[model samples]
Target: MEQEEALDWTIRTRDPDFRDWDAFTRWLEAAPGHAAAYDALMLADADLPALVPAEPLFAGTPANDRGAPASRWRWRWIGGGAIAAALVAALSIGMTNRADIYTVDTRPGEVRVIALDDGTRIEINGGSRLRLDHNDPRFAALDSGEASFTVTHDASDPFRVTVGDTVFEDAGTIFNIVRAGDATRIGVAEGEVIYNPDSDAISLPAGRALREDGRGLTIVSVAPESVASWRQGRLAYDNAPLADVTGDIARSLGIRIVGAPPLRFTGTILLDRDPQRFFARAAPLLGVTARHTRDGWILKERDGPQS
Candidate 1:
């Protein structure tokens, strides 16, 4: 069968009415190729079929149509059978290497500080994902989210943060990189970092920034202390929009803020202080009043206050 036909069949097999456990088991037993096809469809990594063409799978089905209920006997039989089959496969395949993998995730309203084996300190912001290979020495990948790193001085192996084609590397420096969709905003706080893009490379010193785009790199200057302020529980901004400042605030405090724009706030507030107090200081700067609403805090223009 063609790939399209196999996909169609797989879709139909997952239908609510296709709950005949015996029939499905018999079909799997009748042909090894069928089982392989199912696995291929389910296990195709990276190149898996896109869901755009899967609309027909639910053509006539309602949204509320739940899958078939479980059967105790069927569940027990399938569970035991799977265990036996897995044991056989494991014995045949022997041991497979799964590389040293480490995941550090932060839940909403939570802050996490971790120390790696290399003596590097990492403070992960809320709603972030940090994937590290505890063994790979030459380099490591920062898959997504924002993280402040105090890299240990290591002339032997330089730390690298891979954000798309651009790679930020430094042997002994502190920096923060926030991955926002296609673009990555990097702020160098201490020492120097090499921002490399393909064949080109640019050295970024402390209090400097380099924004990477599809075309090339754009260099700019930033205050080093402001970028590293997260370590001290503070959101420092200078000529930054309300949107950008709010994002940093939400990440640092693990709280959500929703309100209108034109909130031009530019100042530094100690994040360790009470969140409400921080908002009070920020609101006056932005010409807005901070109020507690159903969803965290909302900053709006004051009703009436003489300048």
Candidate 2:
């Protein structure tokens, strides 16, 4: 019954003519978690606009038809089966949105460039997933992997990217965000950005980057030119551990790295879009040698002097 009421409020609040704020506020405050539940339902509905073809949904409907009933538009666009299928997809991915959301997913070793409706652009790295709200052009959600965003600023509707509970709010910026496991790294290339990890918010300007994880936030200096190096088939690592570099290489090449011998590596590794070339250049720097096997590349400590 509570869930039903919350869903009702979710639909009702979106109605332009529904102005009963006092009663709605009273109902929301009357129970704990009601507002949260309502918010979740609204978020779920936001993705419904994207599940169906826009032509069939809006063909007969006249533009700027404010006089038409809200239920008419709701039934026209949403069907029970469509909603069920969309819900399943959303639940499986842990991301939900209205019908007007655009999503891009890339396979391992595949990179994609996305031009959004609002003139904002995104470069999605290998094995990454990105979602944008079409209705609210300023909002986006990065579900996993890495992506670099070049936002077309609108101060009235500030651009925001949500990664887990953390939010990166742009102040007219170009930034790269990488999500590996539970850790997230944000690098600002141009202008500045406001990062909110849970309740704490921090401002990061150009040439600065930060990583957040279970331990805490660790800020670092990153060259602005290296912000989206992956787009050019290069990776710039500044004092990064061997394991992290290996993981990136594996993802970028669509190959697994086995028996990785650890060593401190700090330099810009040019991938050249060739897995073998990358391994040849990277192995010597880490005091290791790469042996290509049937399964994948195996890194072993150099048999003689460091290559």
Tens-digit per-residue lDDT, 1-307, candidate 1: 4333234334445445555545554554465345444434433322322421323243465666544433322232244454324433432232133334445556544556766667888888876776666466435566666788888877777888777667888847999887655657788899988887345667888998766646556677888988867777777766665766666777777777885476556677667446777886667766777788778888777767626
Q: Report, for every candidate in turn, its global Cα lDDT versus the true structure.
A: 0.62, 0.73
Determine the backbone clash count of candidate 1.
0
List model 2 lDDT by residue over 258-289, tens digit each.
Answer: 86665667788777567687777777877788
Worst 10 residues of 1 by lDDT: 45-54
- List candidate 1 stretches off by more than 4 Å: 1-99, 212-218, 259-264, 272-274, 301-307
The ten-residue window of minimal lDDT in model 2 covers: 89-98
* TM-score of model 1 (CA atoms): 0.61
**Candidate 2, 85: how far from true, in Å?**
14
TM-score of each: 0.61, 0.65
Question: RMSD per prediction, one decimal?
Answer: 11.6, 14.8
What residue pairs are clashing in model 2? 46-97, 46-98, 46-99, 47-97, 47-98, 47-99, 48-98, 48-99, 49-99, 50-99
